[model samples]
Target: MAEALQPGDPAAIGPFRLTARLGAGGMGQVFLGESASGRRVAVKQVRPEIARDPGFRKRFRREVDLAMKAGGFWTAPVVAADPDAESPWVASQYVPGPALDEHIAAQGPMDEAAVRRLGAGLAEALDSFHRIGLVHRDLKPSNILLLDDGPRVIDFGISKAMEDGGGSALTSTGMVVGTPGFMSPEQALGAAVGPASDIFSLASVLVFAATGEPPFGHGASHALLFRVVHAPPRLDGVPPGLVTTLDKCLSKASEGRPSAHEVGAMLTETAAPAAGRPAAEVDAGGIPFDVRAPSPAPESAPTAPNPRAAGAPAQGTYIAPARRVPPPPPAVAPRIPVTPSAVHEFAVQDGGPAVFRRRIRKSALWTALITAVLCTSTALIGQLLAGVFLSVIAILVGFLPRLVGALPLLVRSSLRIDARVLQMRLGGTAFTVTWQDVALVSVSRTGNTLRLVVVLHSDAKRPVPAPLRRPGADDDREAEFLLISWNDQAVTSRAARLHATLAAAAGPAYRPPVRG
Candidate 1:
């Protein structure tokens, strides 16, 4: 969906220079951009008026945070953002692929196996978002990119953050934020949208992918919304393998829908033996998440075999059965019960309460042991020097308080998120920051290590000491505002868990940590 940049587009926003227009949405224009160093990105700049609104800027900030968490192999990850700019803009990794709508229009509907792969990938993307307490209220073909590998979910433009009850938190008064035909029943009714609404939309997308048509058939906005809320989805052309899952997802009652994790599992189980599945003769088919199949060479000679050949059937040509026999259960036949799957059933965080602890310094104990051993050796070797042994004992004993204090058991570097405040204990000192002062918690990459940082709102009355603070402050004075400092050794490995726990704890204030 790349188009030439229009005349009015800015040459650059922050460090990114605009190259081409990606697309436009209700929030703003998205452009293809490149940094001075040649890193490509999709930079979305908010409309001037929208950026001027305080509430919209606040929600834009939330969008940056949610988009950050909407990461996996299945979705574009956020790279950098400036939500406070005059015309706030955010950038994400650029994905080179045609949007799903364009792909369908150029080619045709995806066959069964291809649709299964797309469904699985989309489901996993939703799983990642849902796990982090985020929802893509606007799941549609346009927001999905069909690549040779799989589909990529883009655009968090109007995605709303879910609160304690899993309800939308950023919807404007009298404004519904979703594509009409793809939105859920509750969304159409202006109800509190949640993860289930996304599931409904996901199914609608799958139906579109399978049939080259919207599930309810598209038309006027109000009419589409009404059909979505009142009528059952038109799954007439959906592959048998996907029909039942789509039906469940398109349920009128959101509670009756399957979780993203479950949907992914079901698709994998329901698809035919992947080995026997034919490669897409079409451009949009043949992707298997992990790899892409080669496109078959076109035949120029008249002697080439064809499914519609007058004498013989072609490679992918379907031949009808002579009898009006009962078709073996459609790919989506309910008879194929979905049993539990270890690989498919993944654990996702749903804003549940969790205690996040700062990493313990494992080397502290070994360092203390080595120091004690070295001291004992020095004391023994210099026994004849009279005061040497006593001096060594005094030196080692004198350092006991410092050594013991650094022990993991004694050192207090941890933060607890309460309903009203964030309680932090660092360097044996305790302090509390009200929820209003804290803006977000993110895990960022710096060199080889990744660490967590707590960002405070700019308007906070008592700002925490930052790296930009005045130089020359003593250790004690510095430790007072140590809201975001640590060398979390295990942070790189436990990133997903840490991200979910911190995101849930931080709520709307959470930001996606930077990734390389």
Candidate 2:
């Protein structure tokens, strides 16, 4: 049993004065406190059960030591602590903001762009911690604060720091240190965790933000552990752009995940659209990673020199004639699926923006020929008795090529994405967006569903049109979007890869890739 902290009476620990109790948890009680200079802080005191364990105190002491050393935009700095005292306490800067849980509960789920920014920020924060050889074992929504300025991550190192210091683990012998719903599979199985474990926890936090629920729902801790270890996350409503990042992060094997920096880099690319194009589209539901290529920009527009190319390849630059075309008409956001096939080359057309067309390979032509021949023969046999049938068959033969060419254009143009000079063919029509045009990309999971979204470029005269099937018909349209009812994780993973590629292409303009 732990002694209760009373309100009103100040409890002095070392140089700080405890003012009021903040809250209590399985490990300890947190109190609102102040320093001699009146700086406010949140102080955590070890409970009697933990204090008797000697090892727990050491871990808390180590955490205090580490928090003092780790400082940045995301983590709360440590001010004072007393690990050797009768009741060990750790004090850190008091951040004024609602916990992520409360903020989402009060404000509703965040928009797609905001979630991407959050992921980038958190990943960068964790990267800083990992740089100094520290890992936060217990990362949860409650530990994250949505401050007026931005998000801040708290509870650094205390749980893991304790175990690192040869202290007792949060769980009983053979137990793990993380919360039931958010812990990685390895952590749940009493396996060793490194920086990858923190990445897993980060993905779990994103799940909560996107859908307001953890991947593993409330239940017995043991049951939750079993689920984390054996079953896939129930991602019923997550955005598609985010699925890949979250999936890789939540991989059961540590080796399967990327580092926190890699995740941050991808989110950063999604936040900032390349020049002259729109970012991905996002809505209340989720984020989309639809990268559409813009019309061929005028050749007179000076191309920025590639810094990477300076030292490596000596490929000659090709310059096309310049023409002052009218400002591009409102673009259409396409719902593209990121596929391994020649999506990149598909965005380019011979006529540039004047006439939108995709270059088909010989193989595609052969396949289309076989399909049309089969269809034409069937139609001729069925309608042979009608005089108009011959005319219709002749017309069909003439129009078959046009139909084949137009079908893919109509379908794919809607799913295109272009980040400035870096054109990406997502699906449907190939999209071309300048690097400066993209705003953000996000990933989320709800139950077993995953979603990804890209916020297109802001500051446009009119919103871009959604991808549509009928010519000149605007009402029935697909929003600038990407959807993968299944394998959504693969999409997010591909977006993350593209993000890295675009960021490298973007240079300094990429600017701290993640959003708040």
Candidate 3:
């Protein structure tokens, strides 16, 4: 990955002396260097053209600060830097292996186990970046180095720093910073890029490692961008054991993809994946127990970062939590049919449509019956005709909520989606929301249940379709519409799968599942 130092290249930078030309990139020229005490490093100096720009300088300094904060684990940590210098430069622990792109080109596709290791290493690196409130917006094969130990994630500072500062200084022509064929849908749309966005790109990288080509074919940037935003992933040659896992990772919606940690769990699950076993059947608690590091505090929000405010780590000794494999469900039944109204529109959608429905009619009917009978018996037994009439009226009033909810169940209630619309029939209500009108989709808390909801655009038509009311709705369904109670297995046995599916169909509308 390195060549002899060319003419005009600096012989020395601070204490480290340049040895060879590593490469040139979007940032600047990289050189192989060594410290006075003999520590080898990869030094990156800003391009003279961009180094003079005030904005790039600010970002360069932030990059230095960020690399320092992102102490080495599956990443190359900053060793020395001069962000304030004439041509600001920073050096990091030099990784000897070639970039993943180069390796794949020189060799061939890696074996499944190698790809698994790569995914796990990259996931850990991305996790570290995210925990520090950074999004590696530019995650291509070139940014990853293949090492005997693991893969190393690089170029974390430039574009994401531009995003955090509230603009795209590093990009032009209405484009967001990311490599074509690998960018997530939201990034293609220049929307909010979160940790899940990185997960989406991680899937692409894994696909490339296993297939020699990205999930989306490479060519003109426009074609790649359009395909990323509108097309389903091409997973033809992908390994069978990885197909299910990668499909979830390639979801268009950021929220639809698994978390980096979750992806790591899926890829690194080592139950031997017994012959014909499903790849998606993974243990959620499969984080590596051997690679010890401080577990970062949970994030408060999922959005772009601001370096000054990205929380400082709280001091503590962190241990990997004990693994708990979820028990298999007692029985798995075929999905209930979707209501005809919702079915027709989604029929054209690609295969494997998600159907969320349950048989709760009996329970709801019993509750209603019990209430009416109790109220009627007390009044009628007293022979007070007026009281009986009043009691009956009161019963009607009391049953309003239940009646509305029971109607759908009595009929055919379910939630269904396609690439274009989210059609839901719930609580005597039927409504649809298109992906264009969706501002974002999220999981929110209402009462004791976790709700999967669609947060709509301001001008989107209302009343939005929600099975029940969220706090700010004030009984008005227009705020954020709830589709299903995620906590209830009776609603649908596949909660995680459902969330990812909604996130995928929602496309750019998916947000991280934070119950607010």
Candidate 4:
């Protein structure tokens, strides 16, 4: 249940009228709100401090776009957003269910069937994110809502685009973006993350759902982070049938974990047989896996013979009919092209130069103002020489570097597409790739900025620029690179065409952004 709105909470945000407080976090407060049309929404208002940071605003807007792009069936659909507001905010459809954490706390651990359902639902949700280019960096129990239909994954606050420019400013060297107990090994190590990272976290969430205890157990954040990186998960009370699949999800290597689609199938298969039924009998049906209902027994199936029936010999042994075990399901092959298609060609260039220049100017102006204020304040305290020295130092240490860095924004970068090769020139650097060397191509749009991500086939390649680097590049074993990024409102109209063109060129390798 939501708590009544507090004294200081805003009565309204954008078009939504705030009525109650759903939750609060370090970055923001979530409120239960209602629109004039009677539609309910969960409005998240970022704290003033976080909203003030330009970098955080950029990340927040990017994440909001990703959240909006995510499929609505398994997630709290993003209904509206005002990232440019005084206190940046986003509103998603109001999910009328308790969080998984609250449900577990109030009702105790979930039973095997319930856990299976939860696993399937959450896996499907993650699959939706993976299909696009997003990863729910935080996938803890609290982030999941248990509804009558199924679980709904919420709180995409920390989600990063697997594509380019998805990293959050909150995470830096030695800092991480996820909860300790739920973090994957790579995440704990502050390494680059991918879809597999969410898979690892999903396994941890399943363990918690089954046993009511996080797989890593309880401790200080540092200790839990350490254990997540080095120790095997504790599955003391997890159901036997789920242990193998969960263990695979918790694998130290990201590639070792199963895909979300595969995990859904595994959970479905594992949950097929009714309680106490022989595994062999269940496998013999060759029925498509469905977690919601068990396959019905055939009409001609024979009942088990009763051993206690009257007979001439009291202790006579009777042999039961043998049951044939079905063959294991076919392995899910990695997304590789079965055959090459005809070479296609397309190209794109930075179309937002005017916007980029305006942004750079604003940033430079803010930096200069802040620097001047600091120096002037020092001088007002009767320290003229010190103020002058500090001002010069500040300009050299901060202003000059930022000004120099912004110079690249003026350079015209373009992506050239050929039948079998992808090439890009950003400022003074040039990156080239063969079609065979490309693993995945994904696109994401945040307001006016459009980002295209190109994942390489190997991790041995040198790191590329931030606009061209994959999210979590530090732990990027797949060597994913950013292909192109630009911030232009005019190009937004052509985004779909560009994305479709690229997808056609990349064929099966492209992972297009989710549209609805």
For all candidates, what are the clash counts?
6, 86, 0, 3
Q: Write the per-residue lDDT of candidate 2 for residues 1-516, one digit (tens) a residue.
A: 123467643477678777677676446777787888899888777766667775666566666666677787778887777878887777889887778887666544444455776787789788888877678878888888765345688875344642363425555454466787888877876776778989988998888777666876554454456557655775545677778778888887889988999998777665655355566443222323322322343567533333323343222211111212222323642221122321222221123322323333443465556556656675777843453555455456654575464443333322333333433343443434554554554434443233334444555223333431224434332123333322445544444433433333333333323435
Estimate the TM-score for candidate 3: 0.52
Where does candidate 2 stray beyond 4 Å? 1-10, 161-172, 272-516
TM-scores of the candidates are 0.54, 0.51, 0.52, 0.54
Worst window of 10 by summed lDDT in candidate 3: 344-353
Model 4 alpha-carbon drift over 4 Å, by segment: 165-167, 276-516
Candidate with best TM-score: 1
Ten contiguous residues with the weakest lDDT in model 1: 342-351
Write the residue-wise lDDT of candidate 1 on 329-418 in tens digits. 345312111112201111111111221212123334544565566667766877445445554565466545544433433334555543
Model 2: number of backbone collisions: 86
Report the poorest 10 consecutive residues by lDDT, candidate 2: 315-324
Q: What digit string (tens of lDDT, one per residue) describes model 4 on residues 329-393?
A: 34742222211332322224342466567766776687678778877898799877887787677
- Tell me the tens digit of each residue's lDDT in model 3 across 1-516: 789988888999878999999887667888899998889998888878667766777766776787688875678888888978998888889887679987666555655555776788788888778877777777889989865445788765454642474655555434456787888888877776778888889999988888777887654464466568766777766768889999999987677788877887887765253234233222233433222222222364222222223454232211211112222334632122222332222111111113212324444465567656666776677755755565566556655554464443344445666656777665466777776787767765444244666666777766564443456665443433343342444334234435545544555466655445
Instruction: Give the runs in model 3 whose Cα sits over 4 Å from its true position.
Output: 157-165, 172-175, 270-516
- Which of the numbered candidates is closest to the native, going by highest lDDT? 4
lDDT of each: 0.65, 0.58, 0.64, 0.70
Q: Over the full model, what C-alpha lDDT does candidate 3 score relative to the true structure?
A: 0.64
